[model samples]
Target: MAEPITLTAPNNTSYSQPTGLFINNEFVAAKSGETIETVNPFDESLIAKVAAAGSEDVDVAVAAARAAFKNPAWRGLSAADRGALLYKLSELCERDKHILATIDAWDNGKPYQVALDEDLAETAAVFKYYGGWADKIYGQIIETSDAKLAYTRHEPIAEQTPLSVLYLGTLIKEAGFPPGVVNIINGYGRTAGAALAEHLGVDKIAFTGSTTTGKAIMRAASVNLKNITLETGGKSPLIVFDDADLDQAVKWSYVGIMGGMGQVCTSTSRIYVQDTIYDKFLDRFKEYTVENTTSGSQFDEKTTHGPQISKTQQEKILGYVESAKSEGGRLLLGGKPGAEKGYFVEPTIFADTKNHMKAVREEIFGPFVVIQSFSSDEDAIEKANDTEYGLGAAVFSRDIVRAHKAAAAIEAGMVWVNSSQDSHFGIPFGGYKQSGIGRELGQYALSAYTQVKAVHAATCSGAHASPYRSGIISRNSSLDRGSILQAGDHVSPSKRPGAKA
Candidate 1:
């Protein structure tokens, strides 16, 4: 078995960090006993070495999960019972929010305050929100003729291993979930992640990462034709109209690209301001950056800005800065390291940038943003929708009608009016085009883990050689005599589902 490593917080509080692969409700060493070093990004110092998973370890985890899926301890639970377990987990998360926030602050390089106030709060909310939906997982009953019954059932697509945080495993165990129902392993994406994606025993996969890696997972999952959901890369746009509240827009724009150190997939790295207030916006934005932002250790109470997740990430952001300079993008403010040590980068901005520039077209995934001016609403919409990514965009305007109009025109999966980056637990979150394949959060997320099954019971035999069995209705369902379908029913037009209307 692997042992837990202890660490002290800046506030002088101590906690044990579990340094093992959590499988079968226990923390155990990897098959090879290899370890991954967990570093504190605030100081670039060693924290502890956690057990690392290889392909062989993945096999063991998968086997355990398969057994648990069959075991009555997991399979026999009612939906409400399962939800109760999740609710207990949420309560545990709430109780330990401070410690969880501290772990993310040290390991992920986010400010402890924000992690506590925003990240941990949201984490607990997510679990509680989804837990509430467990008992409400309902299907529709179709209208069938007398002596006939037809309906559909939304069945669980997942029965085995669910992936999550190294800390979450402890929470799951504490919440009284069955062993192997949820497994977490620490390892690089190549070995353990790939093995899980390719495993035949796993029926589905939901991944949150870069578009490149999402594509790789899709390919590996092809071995079993596993159902997959990918939340991938983005270079989303945030537009500011001339009539917008200038201060609000400026402050939100800062939060847009600076939250999570701009590591968010839906970060609004591209901004379009109306030509009328372009210069003023930039001046105010620069002033706001100077006054409102701070860079330091995540443990420090004064710190607002934190370091990049790793040395590699810091270097990559720096490289993108150089690329911005070379591509004729004018630097407005902050284009270097914020401090002499750690993986800190200054909150950078590139103004007067062209749409074709790498700084605008690509997802830098750092605390960097490019600002541009638009002469007209048409121009703004066109510029915002020009990127291959359609993850998210924001529109700010005093006129709600105009704001909504512009929001509708933007070719993105989600759009915000008078706000940016802030999301609710009840909202569906995801992207379009290359940004992702499906949605998460709210009712949409429940669907991602569900499979629909249609049921047909013929109490009366020879009912016109069975309707809907041929996947086609020769006549209009409403016009047919004794048909149970009501008027205005949406009919499947043809056998070829992909055919355009």
Candidate 2:
């Protein structure tokens, strides 16, 4: 069994992090008894070790979920009651926001203040929004002929067996949810994630990760035809017109790519500026980026950027930078690794990048931005849409009509007007094409998490009358010999008339 490990943040706040899989509202060691070390990206120091779940752990978690779903304690709960529980969980998250933020900063290498103020706040708000929707998941009544009435119902899914996902399980238990209602197991994607994706008992899978892994999950889930919702990789573009506010465009472009060390899936990595103001925009953007962007420990209050999540990620970002330079991309500023110890990359920018450049085509998932100049609106749209990815995008223009028109034409899921990286809990978030499938956030997310079942009830006058009897009518008989018959009253079945069944 893996023992809880104590971690102390730069602020001297100490915590005993859980090192076990959370299942049936209890934290327990993985059946395999293996562990994976969790390290801090800022200093490359060991933070803690978490239990590494395997196929057996996934099975246990799925079985627990299946049993809980079958239990009336969970299945019999009213939608309002379930919603109350979610609300309670959101409240608990808000209460412990500071600790959560610290953990996120240590684990994910995002600025602590930003994690607290933005990411954690948004997470809580999302839960609260979904809570409000729990009781309002209504199904419509379909119009049909004969004495039949139909309606539908929605249901929940099973497990998420990742370290990040386990945090939700902890919150759910704190909110007083029933045992096994939500299970969390921690391990590598190849073992735990694949097992959960292929599990027959798991009715749905909501994944947010790389497109490569998302494809694997899709293939695995195809075996059971499990419902899948994927929010995958993005090589998004931020288009700035000649008439746009230069300062606003520069700031938003920075936020879109450099925010969270560019680990966001919807980061605007490719930037297109109008040729008329291209040079001016590039000079100002470089100045702003160099002057404002700071990289260091996430806990430092002055740090605007943090280290990459892992050594492997840092290497990947560096590789992309080298590839960009080799492919004729001019390095504008900061194209190398940061400090000696940690997994940090300097805020890198490449100019005069072509559409075919690796830095523009692939998802670096680091603080790297590629700038390209466009001659016209058509050129900008064509370049932006010239990727397999169709995730988030941005358009900046003073003309409202032109901006909206460009936004509509962009081949992406979400588009921001004169802004970037601004997301709301109420708005639907997802991507198009290879970026992802289905949607997350808003009421649309409920569709992915729940299934709809149609139910029909017969309302015939006679209790013992067969439901098929109404459809059977005499071929040669007429209700009124001299009267005209209604369209529905005519029978066309071979069993009743001179027609094929």
Candidate 3:
């Protein structure tokens, strides 16, 4: 293999890049020797050549994970040890923050600074937060008979790797986790992803991507009844009341749609403003969006918005803009491709959009937003909840009580009052309705990664009767009508009043 090459960022920071799949604590090539070119979105230059895993390779990775899960060397480790390893991984990420951020920026088409300061920072914080929870995963004891004891144990799901999940496998290895405990395989959704989801050995699948893809995974997982946690696409709504601070609402709304190049699943693409200040807000919102959203290279220090992830995504966003215009929506500003090269689209805004418009209801997954006017809070709520998606919603109002009420009424997994896209490591993140299934981050994420198994044990030698044992009873007996033995009244089946003896 060639020596690792260091690339310099716009800020003069250096990063050493990885070009291979990480599996069983080692960087290796795909068994089929297939490769996928990782391109820099800014110039479409080859950043690295990643090993493209196929179904066979996925099987190998899954087998390794299964073996490791069964091996006491990993599964038998104390929770404290597991937590310590995660903490070590967090530290390693912190030390290599610059390199990790550069890699993400190059691959994902996000600004370098934003990747470093926000995405990488949040990732590290997530590891640390989950690390603290490793030893605290406790189960409740049921109030059964004193002679019987029942408790639960949380166990990690085996295998089931994701496309982007390979990025974290190196960190797991660096943290001194046992080999095979966390395996990474990279490939397209049809091959490697499908294989992982359908593999019977996999106990669970935690997926974060488009709703269409999430549905596919769910279907595949159903074959084996595997546990699934999906965080899917969204068409979240942002409501700006007349009582809201216009400046704050405008700024936050801009950040909500334009941030991450509108690639976030929870981007508030559907915006509603109270009719009283609708025109005024749109004017300022358009001006602010045009002035602030600077699209260019990911490494550019002044670039607030980077190029879309790929040519297809850029075309997709542009297509949505065309659809919006075709639907009679008025373009307020920026409805064209970037003047320069690369997959860049200007931050686009549309007004006079209806709830039924495709651009307003669907997830464009780009720097595009649709704005509409609402007569009152009820109207805004109705419009926001009109879509099938219910991932996230935001309410901007000076009246705290009204804002909270509006937020509560919105049909979404998350609600923000006078804010947008502000997420925390400890906060549970997920969606409602078709947006996703189950929650991620915080303690809720632990539930996704683990399975709950209950155990019942008999504490008394004479109380060894099986809970499912059949019995006979009489009307005069202390046993309940359902044949359940009353507390402190265990009756032998043969000694029952209606016994055949």
Candidate 4:
């Protein structure tokens, strides 16, 4: 049996005061003075009350952001200077990593060490990477005919564009955009989220969360045609080939699915194994889970998996397990929530799962896995790409050529070879199909946040009329040099050096 982890509100801690909405670098109360109580998902204990930003508070935040964007101090700063601020923020986050990690553990219900090490570290890296690119946003110059010059100017789209809502606040601290150039208002999606997305002033909206909500944001932004980027839900697949390193594949699967309580959007929820090694792989995978993972609190280093974000989530995962069994999916291991005070579920695995079952189709968003066997490579690709989501997928194989081929055929924005759940800062992360629009991360991320304009200069000394009595003739004649450059020295036969009349 796993033990319950408990947390109580500390009177002496800095967080004793309720955390309020962060707007314009200041925390303030909502207009209605409404608030929501954050409960520890583990013990259902009162953690802290967060201000629920109503329409009025959202208005204030947007207005403040607008002011900052227009202000000379922020708008006039060079991109290099802006990036430096992000670098500073990253340093500050590293200094207080321990404290922030604790907050995430207590509020988000993930392990303390992971929150500190992986989440916080990655958050800092994200900021640093973007910061480095701040000054590097560039455009291209194109050559034209007749001394004409043209170039494209890459510039910030507008003031206070809400590119995304970093629900994971740690990512926000890591994004390092200039204060006014990138504003984040912390509030529920129904209120603040909706306002930011639909606000006429906002140029674009980028969101990462459940698909159900992604549609809502799209609908709201549609009214204004506000540019949108969504990194939505995913039912990612992991294909284990017959020639794979079985031990590593099984171990990596365990880490990917069970590490974050299976809360990650790209977590490998669906595992497809070649028939030759199906039973063997299952044996090792189940053994690893039983020996390693345990349902428990977020603070314990001994526990590999913790409670879901809340009780509702716990019920949802349990429901899927039942649905899977009812639909003829064989439950290989755990299928029930642990008998404990917290919202914890066992590290469950199901075998012989059908393609159409809810567990296999929907994003379970909990610690659960469904397994099915594939007889051929084509079948494995078919099974993996069956989901509507094309967010991410993984393949394990010893042959490099086979791995690359499988990775290419997998219908996902990103694919992993012989590994799972590893993400880097410069690599772009987003999905194709229903996974969402626009990439986030690296220079691609910055591209989604900006727009482009072309600048052209036409130098001409007028007053000399065209000999053909047409000004457009000069435009065509001037193109000869450009055409020569573009198409090589292929002059007309009449103008050839030796054959010319």
Candidate 5:
């Protein structure tokens, strides 16, 4: 059995991080005595064993969240007040940015500096942006006849919502959803994840991870007829047109392929080059890959790429490289596992790949990119949207009209022009089709996290009477269905308390 691992700061660093589960407003141990070990991909060694929550812990977390929601302190509070709290949390996150970034680096094998600057900054921005939208929510009313007034009330659905806070502080306080409206319990997608999804109290579940895990989450969420928003795996496409800047395209494309060690959900794993610039793009891409292939520990200042999150992930990436070769995708550079004693797969680039190959279809969530050729705009769009997943896509072209046309044709939620992965906190981010449902980030994120309720104070006159007041039905009467609004349908006063007739 794995034991809880305690983390101590090196030298005089005062970073006493929380190792146990964070439930409700406090961190506590699991009700069940299970634990999960955090493996260091740098050395393929066990780093720490954290308290693992099972079904019992899930029940406790859900109950606490339920209590918080029902109480006047949380859910009953005004939207402005909730927004204030979220803003405060964002401020706190920003204050302790270094600590959280270090935690993310240790937990998820990304470079420490990148995690500190980019990941943590974006996480804080997401919360702060939604915090501003908390009080700005509103509803609408439709115009009706003089005798009738019809309005719609958008209301928040009250039910248990379990979320996975993957890779330590990556999504902590990042979600812009309503407070107490959605509950998040952090654990791996097996026991804690499965239990939360299958919990009868939960109404919706949102996940961001591998496709295999997404299928599991969907299956579990199905048990209770719960809605799901899954941001699963992606082998996103990056199209480089003949008119694109070769130097810029090659650099940015490689960044997308290996940024965060290429662990991003919408990482550009597939590259499509126009036949005119196909050879040029390949030459520059291969040159950059060869010149910039350096790997060590994530904390190393000189290291450009880091190891996979675990030994299993490393093995899976290596297996794909072998599979790609067998499936007829020619390896241009770095196709084998690294020699370092860690979960390191070399920054791989495969050329001569076809859209039909497994490398093109599957998401190799590592430092891997597959390049293929396209002859026309229609064919490029067809190949781009051919995957089962459509999270994010990018097209590199100087022609604005052609870029926009291609952007509209690609079936992904987010599309980039002349860039690969340029995400902003103010923009809505999520996938179309099987990639995910709804959107996250910006003011739009508040919509997914909340609902609207409308209140009207109209005069208590007979203005809301039946639409058809005439007793006789004319030749061209629109109110042919007289049974819907009869003048004296209520037989007695007791039967119809608010009847006008």
Candidate 6:
């Protein structure tokens, strides 16, 4: 058993924090005695020492998961029972929301309220939504010869990874999943994460992190031909048309780039305003941003914004601010450190930026955004699609037709009209281009965990010329269903359908 460390937040919230590598439904120490220091990003204080898993620990964890995959207790479980386990896990998460939120605020430098009210809530909803889909996963019938019955069967691909550190394991432990059904480990992405990606025992990998790391995992998984679903980097765009409700657009634009200190992967840091309203929109946007943003300790209720995840992140963001300045991007709002001690950064906006500049093209994961003006819809679409990333985008306009047109034209997996970053657990979430691979949430996420196999069996009375009709000259169906007459002279297929154009 792992020891629990007691912690007290600035707000007087006390909780027992777990710091272990969870495997086979139990918490254990790293084989190398390695530990990663969990730091409180709010004030650079040490939170606790969490066990650091390496290649050896990952190998052990994967072995356990592989064993569980073959275990009758798990493999023989009914689909509804699997879903029930997920539902119970979701409830466990909701029950411990405060503890989880406090951990997030302390470790991730996010506002406690946002972590508690939004992030934790959304996570619970996600598990519940997927739980509802456990029994609904099905494959369709394929058209083949009348002599053989053919269909597809889906099976669990591999291990169930932890959503994040600490609290998730507690929930899994409390949820009563069979031993080895889930595993959690804590270590640097370069070590433990790389091992999981490259481990031959792992059949599927679902990762969400930096684009560089995602690419590295892609390369690693190629060795085993594992199924990989990555939700990676984004320098997404949000366009504000001339006829849009300026106040609404300004509000959403602020939320798009400035929310979460712009650490979100889908943060719309690139804003293109129609030239007819560009100046006015900028004016209103600045006022709204300044009025709304207040960077301070994550535990402070009055603080609408929190610090970056670390001092390194803070310096990286500040460096980007300087790069924007050097590139001649107009600094429209706050551009300095947010607090004296904490890793806080004031929300900054740069106007008059060009598309070709690094300040405009790169994914600067910070509370900094750049603005540009476009003369027409064609110009807006062109500028928005300029980035190599295409995760998320949004369009704002009063004209419904124009809004939808721009939304469709923007090359992103998820596009919103007259809104920004609104996500639903029941809707698919992922990206296109270099942004990522497959979708994560909704029914589509099942594809990540399940593998399909086509099963065919012969039902013919006796041996025929061939099991498949290779002699058929026609590329279309040999005969139409519900009709006595054959559709084509090529009958070697014998009622079998052909490939469609």
Error of 4 at 362 (Å): 0.6
Off by over 4 Å in 3: 1-15, 158-168, 464-501
Which digits, one per residue and each the tens of the lDDT, describe model 2 over residues 1-501?
A: 345567677767676666788889988998878877877888888777778889999999999998999899999999999999989998988987887888888787888899899988988887888889989988878755456667787756511113345556667888989999887787889888989899998888889899999999999999989989998999999999999999999999999999988989999999999999999999999999988988888999999989898899899999998899999999998878879989899999999999987788889999999999999999999999999999999999999999999999999999999999898888889999999999988878778888788876657654445434434343345532333346777653544433345
lDDT of the candidates, in the order given:
0.86, 0.85, 0.83, 0.76, 0.72, 0.85
Per-residue alpha-carbon lDDT of candidate 1 for residues 1-501, written as tens digits (9 for 90 to 100):
777777886656588778889999999999988877777777878877778799998898889999998899989998899999989999999998888888778777888899899988999988888888999999888875665678999988610111127777889999999999998877878878888998998898999888889999999999988989999999989999999999999999999998888988889899999999999999999899888888998888998899988888899889988898999999988889878889999999999999999888988889999999999999999999998889999999999999989988998889988888988878999998999888889898888899999997666464565555543465555434434455676656552233356
Instruction: Give the C-alpha lDDT of model 5.
Output: 0.72
**How many residue pairs of model 2 clash at the backbone?**
0
Clashes of each: 0, 0, 0, 2, 1, 0
Candidate 6 local distance difference test against the native: 0.85
lDDT (Cα) of model 2: 0.85
TM-score of each: 0.91, 0.91, 0.90, 0.86, 0.85, 0.91
Which of 1 and 3 is the better model by TM-score?
Answer: 1
Tens-digit per-residue lDDT, 1-501, candidate 4: 111123342212233222455555544566677666677777888765556667677677667778877888778888899888778767767776666666677676788778888988988788788878889888898875454567987777511111112222333434444444444454677877888778877677878898889989998888779878899999999999999999999998987788799989999999999999999999999999999876566777765677888788889999998899899998988887775688888889999998999899999988899999999999999999998999989999999999999999998999989889888878899998888888988778888878888876655742243433423345356553322223456767666534545
- Tell me the TM-score of model 3: 0.90
- Per-residue CA lDDT of candidate 5, range 34-139, in tens? 6566766677666565567788888887776676667776667787987886787688778877767766666666777888889889877877887887787767
As a whole number from 0 to 100, the lDDT of residue 194 in candidate 2 is: 89
Model 4: CA > 4 A from native: 1-18, 158-184, 460-501
**Cα RMSD (Å) per model?**
6.9, 5.1, 4.8, 8.6, 6.0, 6.5
Error of model 2, residue 51, in angstroms: 0.3
Worst 10 residues of 4 by lDDT: 158-167
Q: Rate residue 489 of model 6 by lDDT.
A: 48
